[model samples]
Target: MSLRRRMCTVAAGAAAAPFVLVMLPAGVANAHGYVSDPPSRQAQCADGTVECGPIQWEPQSVEGPKGLDMCSGGNARFAELDNDHHGWEVTDVASTVEFSWTKTAAHSTRDWQYFIDGDLVAEFDGGNEQPPFSVDHTVDLSDYSGEHTVLAVWNIADTANAFYACTDVNIT
Candidate 1:
């Protein structure tokens, strides 16, 4: 095309760039995560088994300050996971169980820990690099019996925070 027309086309493209950027969502908005396997309390809500608030939309985002025992990851918005009367769905498994997590934003992992009735059952080093989009860990549960709650924590290497999930299960 002619030089003038070409210049006009370039100017139009430049003017539209800002609009395109504005239409896209922010990156920070997608930086949280949650567990799904065995169905965390928030995951139960995400799957429509239980009615919950905003956590139903972001089940993997139960993030909070590390070292806290709260199940909602210390965020009051997701505190529903901490409640025992929500009638959360339970899973039945053998002496061993598999724990999994879905990572939306791969932050450097510090460690992955599992607890049963407030006692540490399993733990693994998360390394200093970002984990895969999905992670699965096999934990030995031969020592426990009957039913119990499993609280899994994914600690971030670069932050004093962690992602939390709780799953109720019956051992066979």
Candidate 2:
């Protein structure tokens, strides 16, 4: 092509460079990943039941994969909490505990129970048509101190089966 036409082509390509850059992934800018330090993976119990990490109260974000099951008794693709593990230190007995999770798909009903040092403290009821939800609970912890574990037992509402997730417990 002629020199003038080549110059015009170069100018047009330069103008489109910014748009192409914008379309590329801005890695690390908005990336979301599991909060677990060691990256918790799915595990199966002696009875062939799968469980996830011993989560703590630490502030972190995790993204659930597509078709992940939050229910119990089946081969769920996501992580489940270990009810027996506290996962953190308890320093303040009066501080309120907050627990949250996201569901990608809607469920008929979801129920969650909170336990502090193995004691039932609160319960949440997620009704039908609710896909993703969260909860914040404040409980008086003046009766205890030291390291403790806060467990969240979740299950389908009206069902006896349950799954657990945990966060580090500290009462100051």
Candidate 3:
């Protein structure tokens, strides 16, 4: 090869090396599990209606501590549709808030459901044969403001379990 061509090849290889090195582990890491917005350890729902930020679903096998135990299985796969409850406390009842997230699994028998203080707020059906899906919802918090707990449950009958990830929860 010509000298100029050889130099260009070497430069190109050097440039690509870092990109590959940076992206490879990320792909593998994401394949296992991940969390988007993690709450602080000292975070408190003292008023009973505290705004808990976004929460991401991850595989159980992934290292590090988790605020919510929303995982089940050896490979840390997402849960199937069933009666599984994950709870969070809301601090301020008067504040309006929005909750959003993504869901991924092999088989989901039915749609997902949202409950606030034991009341059904919404439901979602991603349809059969869909492995990955996402949804976002916003609701007034004036009624649920004080010391109430919110739960997100999957009501898919006959399924084992299911998992969900919260991308963002803005309370204002």
lDDT of 3 by residue, 1-172 (tens): 9999999999999989988897874321121222212221112221223332222222212222222333222123223211123344223323554544333332333555555534666666656433344345454555543443344433332344443332223233
lDDT of model number 1: 0.86
- For model 1, what is the alpha-carbon lDDT of residue 1? 100
lDDT (tens digit, per residue) of candidate 2 on 1-172: 9999999999999999999999997542221112121112211221123333322221122223222233221323223432344132222434554444433233344555666656777766656333344434455556666656555554544333344444445566
Minimal lDDT window, size 10, model 2: 30-39
- Residue 126 error, candidate 2, Å: 2.8
Clashes of 2: 19
lDDT of 1 by residue, 68-157 (tens): 777888899987889988888888988899888877888888899999888899999987777888999999999998888888999888
List ranges where model 1 is wrong by over 4 Å: 1-30
Candidate 2: TM-score? 0.42
lDDT of 1 at 24: 92
Q: Candidate 2 regions off by >4 Å?
A: 1-94, 128-131, 158-160
